[model samples]
Target: MILSSPDPAADPHVAAALLRLQRTSYAREAVLVGDERISPLLEDEIGLTAWRGRWLMAWDGVQLVGAIAWWETDDAVEIHRVMVSTSAMRRGIASTLLSRVLASASGRPVAAATGRANQPAVALYAKHGFRAESDEQIPPGIWITRFRHAA
Candidate 1:
């Protein structure tokens, strides 16, 4: 049962879920990226309103299980964030979002990037057709890998 959220960014339930997910996700990354670098983005009404991307959320009843945010480029849709609730992991939420991105791309490529040491993210992207495009050092010991999946 795939249903679109009426207003993922404004929905109270969705916002709350995303806030918690952000904290947890950043906490995991802080181990490798440092707390200063991996802190969660400030999520406020204005920030949500200013987001310049398409947003999608997966819900199991009223609970948001996953979310994806992306924007269009000249020849690609760039995925900015894809997160699945800790409780809902390994149940295809991420894959479903990736599939939706692929479908909406209309034959263009989809691009995403994550920290080089985030193995789970790297594997998840690989599992969904994304192949490594580049691995670059961002200085001060930070490394990022970009991946692209042709739609």
Candidate 2:
């Protein structure tokens, strides 16, 4: 496995690949949360490039296996997305990507959110020293659990 900081904004092919990865990954997340309207599932490559967040990608010899995207605020690092292709599951891709993010946070708080029903994601955050701070309801019944890694 290799990790890279691909420029999705500057590279059309990278953006397309990232979009494909995001859709496949988030599609599973939508099923896990039982919500077809999850925002990530609806995002397009154009919308993706607009956010301008920092990204760390994990590759399996030319395959875009996983990626984590985040934004840096004045006092914290807000993780927007952590995605792993369904075919690449159980191989530690998400963990490796997240570990890299936490290591580069430089003591600033790192925040992330996942569907509250997504136990695997919650466990991953906990394994990396993140604590569940709260649960939010969006569009009424769907629950999202927010986490924070504070050093």
Candidate 3:
């Protein structure tokens, strides 16, 4: 797999593909979390293009398979999204994307959140040295686990 930063302005197709992948990937998360209104699934391509994060896309010989988006702050990097195509799950793609993002963070803390019921995501973050710091409730019943990587 090849990883590259995609410029949405130069390639609108990347944003469209990312939106499709986000919906497809997050649908499973929605089921796991018992919430059909997870942010990724509710987002549209227009909103995706307007997002203020940089994306690292994973490609398997020209096919978009996964992506990780993040924004850098003064002292922390906030990971907005980490998505792998449903067909590409369990292939180490997400881990690879996360590794790249962490490397690019240049020692700043990294923060991310996942649905509380999304065990795979929680485990993935743990594997990368992130610790569960807190939990948040959105829409009343849905719980999200916030994680932070300080290394």
Rank candidates, TM-score, best first.
2, 3, 1
TM-scores vs. true structure, each candidate: 0.81, 0.96, 0.96
Better of 1 and 2 by lDDT: 2
Candidate 1 lDDT by residue in tens digits, 20-115: 666565556556554336424445545654576887778788676778888897787899888777777888888898788889899998889887
- Each model's number of backbone clashes? 0, 0, 0
The residue pairs that clash in candidate 2, if any, are: none
- Cα lDDT of model 3 by residue, 1-151, tens digit: 8889977656788877888889999999999998898889888877888887788999998788999999998788999999999999999999999999999888899999999999999999999999999999976899999999996
Please, what are the lDDT tens digits per residue for candidate 2 over residues 1-151? 9999977999998899999999999988788899978888889888999888899999889999999999997688999999999999988999999988888889999999999988889899999999999998975888999999998
RMSD in Å for all candidates: 2.6, 0.9, 1.0
